[model samples]
Target: MCEQHRTDSALERHGAERSGQPRSCKPAEARRAVERAVTERCRATHTHCDPEALGDALLVASELTTNAILHGGGVTDFRVEVVAAGVRVSVSDRSDRLPVARDPADLRRRQRVGGHGWPIVCRLARDVRVSELPTGGKCITAVVALD
Candidate 1:
């Protein structure tokens, strides 16, 4: 795995390495890499973060990565940062189309096949932001609390 350590900084970013590659196009692979990275780091350092919160982080990662692959034209990069308050995840994709949050009630009434990921992320994350990349596409970042 592509490990990064920055003792001087609170926000330390790291990548998932596989076969000498840091990026993966597949959503499942991306999600797995993210979960693995965070879980391993927490376990190795014996962080006080709760297991349930970690599970929520994994769910958020899966939702974001799936959205990126299905609508964002594949994932370009994935990064997880260790912060003072919690873990931060940033996902980069090829599409410029930003995600729209649909009302849960509306979704239930309309019977849509899929439209819940963004809303779910919003509910679970602390500071969620989406930035437009100059070259094209957008980066979605969400911070999951340790509690």
Candidate 2:
């Protein structure tokens, strides 16, 4: 099994790791790695996640990683874990700026075209959360349901 698969198995069995948890990689490369990891993990665990949902997972991961690099200062690390209910993706960056959802009206009116990534992620993800990383950064996590 690949390292990603091992990490997923560990997470499913033990919840989050105690330390040195998230696997680190470059933001661009990590996005694709996370998508594949999530897909394989879901398949191995007998969860049914369609291509669309998997695509959404990939897109959200890309957006979050992009945000971390562009606005959140840079990517510190990220984790992709398979849970009993769904898969969770967390990306940590060196900024504390909380991600915000853009107004739907603005999105529809094309008043703002650039800041819709977080809102789109919120809409596609089953659950979204943000927390302060102890190592001087912020972590944004999104859960994508297997159902």
Candidate 3:
């Protein structure tokens, strides 16, 4: 199986919060961790989230995590928080390369290998933001609607 499927399987067995430490080993692991956290938090808070929205949240998490790994120099520390309005997934990485959405036209012209992640994130996430970390690197955050 692929790394992402492996991580997802592991998350199925484990509870939401694994070690409370950021997972940087793989993008799939990071994405699964965020998804698990969001699922558990939604259950705990009794938030009304549809399956499609939850799937979108997971997709956004995966995209952001992949962006962080491929462009932001891997993951450092990350957190997923569930608020009243929605879920927030934040990933911190060692690089300060702020993510940007590639123009669709440019993508079609250049035929980039992997420039669609950020744009997918923009569509799936209700809000997206990035901030420089105090110690080092940067954090990319995405907020997904709860319901």
Candidate 4:
């Protein structure tokens, strides 16, 4: 129901590109980009974008950008686009370490705190990818279904 991002030029297209250090690219900014794209781009082409799906897309963007800043040493680059399949959000960060998904209940069945972002992204997005950048870092791309 979603398409994976095909090229790296998307960050350039959105004009939210950053590298090494985050210039305060907050989660709200990324959500706004997704909202704008889904509203303008889909409306321009007369394509249908499901509201629920848009919400999922925005959450994915938030989780990615937030994770970048909190864990990956800030957001290096950000991109959002409304494709035919759905909305695509890509976030680049300064860490090459892949995001690890921890079970909510560990071996002792103890409930964890504040580690739900990765799981939320995985559940909401139809396509998720992690690619190491050539300049040192990693980019995570997620696509949410519009229908």
Which candidate leads the pack in TM-score? Answer: 4
Each candidate structure's TM-score, on Cα atoms with residue i matched to residue i, is 0.75, 0.75, 0.73, 0.81
Q: Write the per-residue lDDT of candidate 4 for residues 23-134, one digit (tens) a residue.
A: 5578888888778777776666576767888899889999999999899998878877666567778899999999999889878999988789999999999999999999
User: lDDT of each structure?
Assistant: 0.72, 0.72, 0.69, 0.80
Using TM-score as the yardstick, the better of models 2 and 3 is 2
- Please estimate how well model 1 matches the true structure, expressed as its whole-model Cα lDDT: 0.72
Q: Candidate 1 lDDT, tens digit per residue, 68-131? A: 8788987776777656667777888899988997665563476666888988999999989999
For residue 46, give model 3's deviation from the true position in Å.
5.0
Worst 10 residues of 3 by lDDT: 1-10
| Worst 10 contiguous positions by lDDT, candidate 2 | 1-10
User: Cα miss at 95, model 2 (Å)?
Assistant: 0.6
- The full ranking of all candidates by lDDT, starting with the best, is 4, 2, 1, 3
Residues 115-141 of candidate 3 have per-residue lDDT tens digits of 889888888888888899998899888
Instruction: Give RMSD to native, each candidate.
Output: 4.4, 4.2, 6.5, 5.6
Q: Which pairs clash (backbone N, Cα, C closer than 3 Å) in model 3?
A: none
Runs in model 3 lying further than 4 Å from the true structure: 1-25, 45-48, 105-110
The whole-model C-alpha lDDT of candidate 2 against the native structure comes to 0.72
lDDT of 2 by residue, 50-140 (tens): 7787777777788888888878887777777666556678788899889886575563575655878888888889999999978788999
Best by lDDT: 4
